[model samples]
Target: MAIYKLDTGWRADYSYYDSFGKRKKKSKRGFKTKRQASEWLTEVIKDINKIKNPYYDWNFVDYFDMNMELKINSGIKSETVNAWQAVRNYIVVKYFSNIKISELTREKYQHFLNEYSIGHTANTVKKRHQILNSVIQQAFHDGIISIDPTYNVRITGTKESKDASEKFLEADELMNLIEHFSQEERLSGNSSLSSFMIVLIAYSGMRAGEALALTKNDINLDHQTISITKTKGRDGINTTPKTKNSVRTIKMPSDFFEIYKLFISHKSEWNKNYELFDGRKIATNPNRTLERYEQKNNFNNIVSIHGLRHSHASYLLSKGINIAYISKRLGHANISITQSIYVHLLNEQAITEEQKTIEMLNGIK
Candidate 1:
């Protein structure tokens, strides 16, 4: 028997027997008028009676996979898809595959974090929690869940910003790396291309993948400028630059131009069987080449191939390039990123200016 109550307001409670013949009670909230209560009761009863859910009825996994595939098909970058997949994999493997979206609770999430992310940085755990919360939100939007289950969850750990531990290569380090590239006696036979790749990555402020994804067509030997058509971003699309400003071309210095030409010529002559680096025509993996080069060269440092990109930004800031220009050149989605990472550099300039002003005041006083 179902119960009806008008204790606070008119309301109807419905009960039904589940598959195991266990009685389940359901109620509706916010039905003030009796007519509204009656309508809501009828709808709720129909819904409760119609649902025949099987065990392990999670569709979010399939939905997420489909959404990721759609993005990849639409020309998003692989790294973006990889990050999302990482989030999904963690949820499935750590939380169990059968965990339903509706069953997610703050306590369970807290427990998961405590167990799996022990000794990991707060930032890492926060990112994982954020991803899971994002999936739950999507489920809500899709009507597969009633509410976002991960809401109001506390993140106990804090993480530094992306550039927290980052420091630019000193001038000596930069020169050493350059000299290392030039020393043929010290290099393995394959070091020449690897050297060029690293130097170009550092000098041009191009992402490693973007540098690797470059086509011969993107490089203008005569004009000494490079066009960056695509880059890897958080969302993983391979379309235009991260921002509209990032889509602009940058001219190389004369010295760089000469080396550029020499490398281009060497690449052209050395490997006639070597195909041009066209994404559409020659779809080789840049990471494979980078890995082999790293293994062969034994270039160990505080950075990776991607670190060259960071080095470029830091070097540009050190040389007094406006943040806006650096931001555009590096394809940063916003000037805020450029400023945030390079804030110390900007502060140093300001301090110098302040010191100069103080000196001038002393002289006058």
Candidate 2:
């Protein structure tokens, strides 16, 4: 091990041989003191030794905890790690608390999944299976198990899928909801940040987190564009968006800027660096507020705040917008993702186009 002092801070570098007798080097920098650097290097060496001699007779739960620690150290996103932890706590641990990793078999795994699917939705069951399968595959790679038990396992869930109406509002309904929020903001004298947020989501189709993380600098009133550069993760504001495609700028409707101008006019002076919405104020279950609006208004269909994004996409589809353009506007990683999510709306559009094609062919004669 070697510790060197730089102009900014101290750095620690170490080299060791792994279990396969291959030499590997590790280095870390930006420590305030040489002592801190030395201590970090020592911890890294200890962790390497522990990995080289992991407990051979560990149960599934025990191994899962260890794997999560390794993943956290390897810099996995906190939100993703938290989701994996949830699956482990709520599903995997309940099913395999006493099962040894090596003793797990295809039959036992399938039985566990079958029981988990008893009352759960298909999407829920699939998510649990995906998380657990990843863990099991990692164990196989580490030689903890000779074969992956989840290789050909079947997943089954009994619950029916949610109706599309429940997932998104119709175009007219969405417009009504937007108008309702706009009127509420007008009546409340622009004191309702949540109201503004709802309208913004309806207009721009940004994720709730992405909208929450927005700042004055992200919006260009002159250009009528909003740049999506970051998101609100579990650990407050993250500097990266959910995906690479989510970093694009979207053109907002001309009317949206009018609403934005009114929304900003009511606020007192604030730094451009500060988030537009107070993070603490809107973080406490904005969905409940949306539900209240739905109940108060006589709308037959209601959706969550995320449903606003869906509603935006559905409204665009209704206006005969191209799916590829919609995909980029929504910042989807690929067009296929947009296609899958809005497949129902796309099917409706397809039927409409087919009829128009038939009418045009008949008119040609």
Candidate 3:
């Protein structure tokens, strides 16, 4: 290894023999100081020695593939595995396909993230970064690299974050929506499965996929509860819930169960495996159904099917429901996840309670 001074900066160069006894050379340049170059070269040498087979030249893409295989073998959900594959194909490969794991620097990784954030939302960019960072972290742990390129990297995106209000309906609006759907189901003699689904999601706070995956056996009329054990993926295939916490039983309104009994009575032929919504009737874009309802009712706030889940949580929060209970009811992995998503609603509730506390204190005087 050698550090040499250049016209503007210093450079570190190294030569070594691989595990196969083949000679190879690597170098990095443009460091401001000789010490910086020496330190980097030392890290590289240490990393090389740590690897059992330094002969294997694995690129970032190669590490990503291995990470994906490990994740699959570890029993990650198919949807999650598919998402990681998409990130690899569309983002990671597009930028870092040829970059060797040892060659990845913080600056280079930051540049790739800056490019990716150009037309994406902050959340979208953050999620993609997390996926890539996981693979890079594994490479570091496996002694393929000395440092995590993702560490302390600032994540930014040009696209504006979505407004929270637009993601859910207020209590009155949600009640009106449910009432409208309920009337539609009754008038149609329980034939409108979409309308029924909208009502179920609004009341139960179940994700659209979880609601769709429900079977006749999952509903308990006597107990006034519904079991959430699985979800329907975007591919129309049934799979386990998103997390272990998602496998839960939640209470439903007795009146809602009455409507359910009426609805189920019309479907006597449905077997235990038969899904709540007919596969043929499940729209590729569920938001279209919400749009139709909004137009018919002249609703000012338009929300997607997933928005009904948000609306459900918002409604419960507005009514002073315990957030921890709400988290479990919504099948969130933890209360923190629920709090982050509905922090705005929680803030509003906090203000109301603060006012009540001040008023009670004043009355004591």
Give the top-scoring candidate (TM-score). Answer: 2
Residue 116 C-alpha lDDT in model 2 = 89
**Candidate 2: which stretches are off by over 4 Å?**
1-53, 184-191, 269-272, 280-284
lDDT of 1 by residue, 180-265 (tens): 55444323344445656666776787766566556566778788898877653434234555456666677777766666666665
Count of clashing residue pairs in every prediction: 3, 0, 0
Estimate candidate 2's RMSD in Å.
14.7
Candidates by TM-score, descending order: 2, 3, 1
TM-score against truth, every candidate: 0.71, 0.80, 0.79
TM-score of 1: 0.71
Candidate 3 structure quality by residue, lDDT tens digits, 141-255? 8666667788899999999977887789878889888787777344255346776787888899898888878888889878889999988766667889988999999999987
* Residues 171-285, model 2: lDDT tens digits: 7888887887776345245336778888889999998888888888899988899999988766664657778999989999898887887777777756556677765323445
Residue 259, candidate 2: alpha-carbon lDDT: 80
Better of 1 and 2 by TM-score: 2
List ranges where model 3 is wrong by over 4 Å.
1-56, 184-191, 235-239, 265-272, 279-283, 295-298
Clashing pairs in 3: none
Write down the lDDT of every candidate, Cα atoms only.
Answer: 0.62, 0.82, 0.82
The better-scoring model by lDDT among 1 and 3 is 3
Each model's Cα RMSD: 7.7, 14.7, 5.5
